[model samples]
Target chain A: MAADRVDPIHQFHINTIVPIHVGGYDLSFTNFSLFMVIAVVLSGGLLYWATAGRRVVPSRSQSVAEMTYEFSASMLKDSAGNEGMRFFPFIFTLFVFVLMANLIGMFPYFPTVTSQLIVTVALALVVFFMVMIAGFVRHGFGFFKLFVPSGIPVALLPLVVAIEIISFFTRPVSHSVRLFANMLAGHITVKVFAGFIFSLGSLGALGVAGAILPLIMVVGLTALEILIAFLQAYVFAMLACIYINDAIHPGH
Target chain B: MFVTSAYAQTAAPSAIEAHEGVAAGGGHEAFPPFNPEYFPSQLLWLAITFIAFYYFVKKVLLPRIGDTIENRRRTIAGNLEEAARMKEDADAAVAAYEQELADARARAHEIATKARDEARAKAENDRKKVEASLDGKLAESEKRIASVKASAMKDVGSIAEDTASMIVERLLGSVASKSDIAAAVKAARE
Candidate 1:
C-alpha cells in the first residue's frame, strides 16, 4: 500500500519566493503575506460598505457596523477608561483584522495567518512598542518608576522591580502565544478528527457506525472553533487596552 | 541482492523512526525570515486602517451620538414647555368658570330679592283695601240702625194716645159734649 499521508504539521510550512537580501538579512514574503493583505482589504471594504450611507436610522448593515464600533468602544472604556479613546482606532483595526483573518480561514482552501507565530508575534510586538512608547512619552523619567510600587520598602524594591520587569517582558509572549495556540490547537483537532472519519470508514459496518461519531465531533468542533476565533480577537483587543491603561497610569 | 533491496524499500518505517528521519533530513528552510523593512505594504495598510477608524469615530460616530442626545434634550424641553402652557390654559379656564359661577349666583340672588320685595308690597296693598272696606261697612250699619229706631218710636206714640181716648169715653156714660169728643179726636190725631 502507498504510504499513509504525512501528519498535518508538515503542511504548515511557509513556501516563499527567492529570498531578498536586505541589510545583511534574508527577507521574503510568504503565504502569510498574502493572507494578511486579503484580511486588510476585506476588513476595510466591509467597514466602508457597512457605513457608506450614514443614515440617521441605521440600516441593517449600518447597525451591525455601529454595534461593532460600540462594542469595542465600550470595552476599551471599561478596560482603559477615557484615556483608552486615544487608542480606539488602533485597537479596533487590530480586532477587525484578526477577526477577519480567523473567519476567512474557515472557508475552503483559505490560509489562517493567526496559526503562524510570526504574524501573531509581530502584532504583539506592535502593541508592546506602543505601550512602551506611550509610557515613556506620558511619564518621561517617571516611566521607570512603574517597576517600583509606591510605599514599598527600599530593601524590597529590588526584588519587586525584578518581578515587575519579568512580568512586563512576558506580556508580548503571552499575548502572541494565546492566539497562536488557540488557532493551532483548534485546526489540529479538526484535522485529526477528519482523519479519524476517513480512516475508520474503510473497516466495515461497525467502522462506518464509528466514523459517524467522529464526523459529528468534527462538525461540532468547527462550530466551536468559529466562536473561539471571535472570542480570541476580542480577548486580544481587550488585553491590549488593559496594557495601554497600565502604560497611561503605571504602578497602580 | 536486487530482490532483497526492493523488499526492504517496500517496508514502512515505524512512526518514531520516520519522525527521526524526517527531522534529520528536513534541513532545507521552508521560507526566508520575515523582516520589518520588507513589510511596507502591511505598514501602509495599518496606517490606512488607523486613519479610517479615527475618522469614523471623530467625524461620524461621535457626532451622531451628540446630535441624538441634543435632539432628545430639545424634545423634552419642548414637551415640558407645551405641558406648562396647557396647565396655564387649564388654570385660566377654571378661574373664568369660578368667576362666572359667582356672577350667576349674585344675579340670581338679586332677582330673588326683588321678587320677594314686590310680593311683600302687593300683600300690603291688599291688606289696606280689605281694612278700608270693613270700616265703611261698619259706618253704613250704624246709620241703618238709627233710621229704624225713629220709625218705631212714632208708631208707639200714636197707639198710646188712642188707648187714653177710649178710657175717657167709658167714664162719661151720657151724651157727652161734641166739643169734648172732637177735642179728644184732635188730640189723638196730633
Candidate 2:
C-alpha cells in the first residue's frame, strides 16, 4: 500500500512557484531555485561566521574553514600548479555548492539540485569552456597537441589520436554524469528501499518483522549517501582542476 | 506506459510550449529527469547564483581568509626567529661564563703554586743560615781544643823535668844543677 508520494522519481520533480516568464521561458522560482538560494546563503553565512574573529590562534570553526580553503587550494595546485590558484574561487564555489546540494538532499523531501542533469551539465560546461578558451588562448594550436601523445608508433598514432579526441570531447559528459548519476542513483535507491518498508509492513506480522531489514538498509544507504555526497564533490572539483591543468600544459 | 504516453507531448512545437502542459500537472507520463522543459530555468538560475557565489568567494571570503592565514604565519615565523635569537644570546652568555670560570681557576692555581714555592724557598734559606752559623762555632771550638792540648803537653814536660831534678838531688844528697838536669832530660827525651 505504498502510495504515489513515495515515488522515487517524484523527489526530482520540479513544480513552478511564483511563476515568472520572460521571453517565453519558464524561469519561475521553483523549489530548485529556492534551495539554490538557500545553499548560497548558508555557505556564505558559514564562511562569514567562521572568519569573524581571525585570531592568531584560530577557533575550532575558524580552523575548519581554513582547512577547507587549504584543501581546495592544494587540490588545484597539486593538479594544476601555482597558476591554477587563479581559478580557486570558482573551483571552491563549485565544490561548496555541490557539497551543500548533496548534503541538503539527504534530508527527506529535499530536492538535490545536483541530481538534475541540466545543472550538472551547466557546471561541467562551465569548466569545459574555461578549459577550451584558456587552452586555445594560451597555447593556440598547441592545445590540439594534447591529443597527440609523444613517442607513439606511426601506424598506431591515428587510433590513439582518435581515442584521445573522443575522450577529450566527452570529458564534460563523464564529469557531469559522474556526480549527477551518483546523486540521482543514491537518492533513488534510498527511496526505493524506503518504499519497501511500507510495502512489506502492510503484509502483517511477518512482513512487519521483515520491514526491519529494509529499515536497516535505509540507514546504511543514507550513511553511504553522505559519503558519496562528499566524495562526488571532491571528485568533481579535482577533475576540474586536472582539466584546467591540461589546458595550461597540454602534452603527452 | 507512462513514458510512451508522455512522448506524445513532444510533438507540441517547442520545449517551452510543452512545459506549460507538463507544469500544469498534465499527468506526467515522461521520465521526469530527462524532461527538457526545466533546463532553461535551471541554467539561468545556475548562472545567476554561481556568478554571485563566485564573486562572494573571490572578493570577500578569500581575501579575508588569506590575510588572516598570512598574518598568522608571519606572526609564528616572527616568534620563532625571536626565540632563536634569544637562545643564541643565552648560549653565548653561558660560554663566556664557562670561559671566565676556567680563567679564574687557572689564575688561582698559579697564585697557589707561587705562594708555596716562595714559602719553601724562605724555609730553605732560614735552614742554610742556621747551618752556616753552627758550622762557624764548631770550627772555633776545634781550634781552641788544639791550642789547649799543646799547652797541657808543655806543662807535662816541665813537671817530668822537675821530678827528674828532685830524684838526682836525692841520689847525690845534694841539689844537682838545673842546667845539668835539664840537659839530661832533653837527651833522654830525644
Candidate 3:
C-alpha cells in the first residue's frame, strides 16, 4: 500500500472513460481528454461570464477578465511588436489551456495535462510550423537569411549555418521538453514528499514530528509549482510570440 | 506491439494490460508519458480542445472582452474631455467677472473725477462773483466820501472870505467896495 501510494507514476495513468474507435485507430476519450474539455469550459465560461457586465468603471471580476486579456496582449506585443497581434487568438488559447491545465493539476488526484509529452510536443510543433510557414510566406526565399548572420567570417560561415539550422529545428523539442519535464518532475516530487507524511504519521509521535519536515517541503514545492504554472504558461506564449516575430521579420 | 492486445483486453484493460504492455517490451516501454499507444488519443484530444478554444476565443470570448475594455476606454476619454470643457468654461466666467469688475472701477473713477472738477468749478465761480460785487461797493463808498469832503471845503472857503471883509470894514470904519471884497475872496480861494 505504501509503495503504490508513493508511486507518483500512477497519477499520470490514462484510463479509458468513453471508448470510441474510428477506422483502425483507438481514439478513446480518456481522463486526459476529460480534463482538456474541462479546461476549455472553465476558461471559456469564466471569460464569458466575467465580462457580461461590461461596466465602464469595471468591478472586481471584470478587472480579472480585463487583466487576463491585457496580460496576454501586452506579452505578445512586447515580444513580437504590435504586428504580432495577428496570432493573438492562437497564442492566447495555448496560454489559457496550458495555464488551466497546470492549475487544475494542483488538486489531489487530478491528472496533469501538460505533463504529457505528446501534448506539449503537439503544441510546440504547431508553433514551429506556424513560424516556418509565416516566414516563407512573408519573406519567400529571403527567409534563409535567419540562418546566415550578416557579420561572419567567410571560413566559419558554413559552421555557423549548420549550428543555426540545428538549433532552429530543435526549437520544438526543447520547448516541449521544458514544460513537460517541469510538470512531470514537480508533480512527482510533491507526491513523493506527501507519501512521507502518510508513512511517518503511522509510526506514532516521533515519526509525526519528523513528517513535519516533508510536509513543509510539500507545501513549499506546491507553492513553487503554482508559480511555475504561471511562469510556464507565460514562457510558452512569450516564446511563441518571439517565434512568430521571427517569422514576421526574418532577419537577424 | 500490443495496441491490438490492449484493444482486445478492453474488458479488463486497467492494470493487467498496463503491466503486461510494460513487460512485453522487456522493460523498454518505460515511462507512461513516453508510451506510443496513448499518444494518438492525447494528440487527437489536444487538437480538438485547442482548436475549439481558438475558435471560441476568436469568435465569442475575445470580442466580448475587447468590447468591454474598449467601451471603458472610450468612456474614460469622454469623461476627461467633458471635465476639460467644464474647466474651460469656468475659467472664462471668472475672466469675464474680473473684466466687469475692472470696467466698473474705471467708470467709478471717471465719475468721481468729473464730480470733483464740477464742484471745484462751481465754488470758484461763486467766489469770483462775490469778490467783484465787494470791489464795486468799495469803489462807490469811496467816491461818496470824497464828494462830501469837497462840499465841506467849499463852505469853509466862503466863510473865511466873509470874515476877512467884515474885519477890514470894522477897522477902517468906512464903507469899502463890495466888488473889491468879492475879488479878494476869489483870489484867496485860488
Query: Could you give candidate 1's per-residue lDDT for residues A1-252 as a string of tens digits?
Result: 211232444334443433334555324444555666677767666767767766656688877777787788888889888986888777877788788888887764566877766677778988999999999999997888778889999999899999999999999999989997898778767877877887888788899999999999989999999999999999989889989888888866
lDDT per residue as tens, model 3, B48-153? 9999999999999888889988888899899999999999999999999999999999999999999999999999999999988988898888888788878888
Candidate 1 RMSD to the correct structure: 10.0
Query: How much of the true A–B contact set does each candidate keep?
Result: 0.05, 0.61, 0.67
> Which residue pairs overlap in candidate 1's backbone?
none
Off by over 4 Å in 3: A1-3, B1-30, B152-190
CAPRI category for model 3: acceptable
Model 2, B22-132: lDDT tens per residue?
653434443455667667778888888889988999999999899999999999999999999999999999999999999999999999999999999999999999999
Q: Evaluate model 1: give its TM-score.
A: 0.65
Which of candidates 1 and 2 is the stronger one according to DockQ?
2
Q: Per candidate, chain B TM-score?
A: 0.55, 0.66, 0.65
Candidate DockQ values, in order, are 0.08, 0.34, 0.48
Predicted candidate 2 versus true structure: per-residue lDDT over A118-185, tens digit per residue: 99999999999999999999999999999999999999999999999999999999999999999999
Clashing pairs in 3: none
Ranking by TM-score: 3, 2, 1
Off by over 4 Å in 1: A1-7, A10-31, A202-205, B1-190
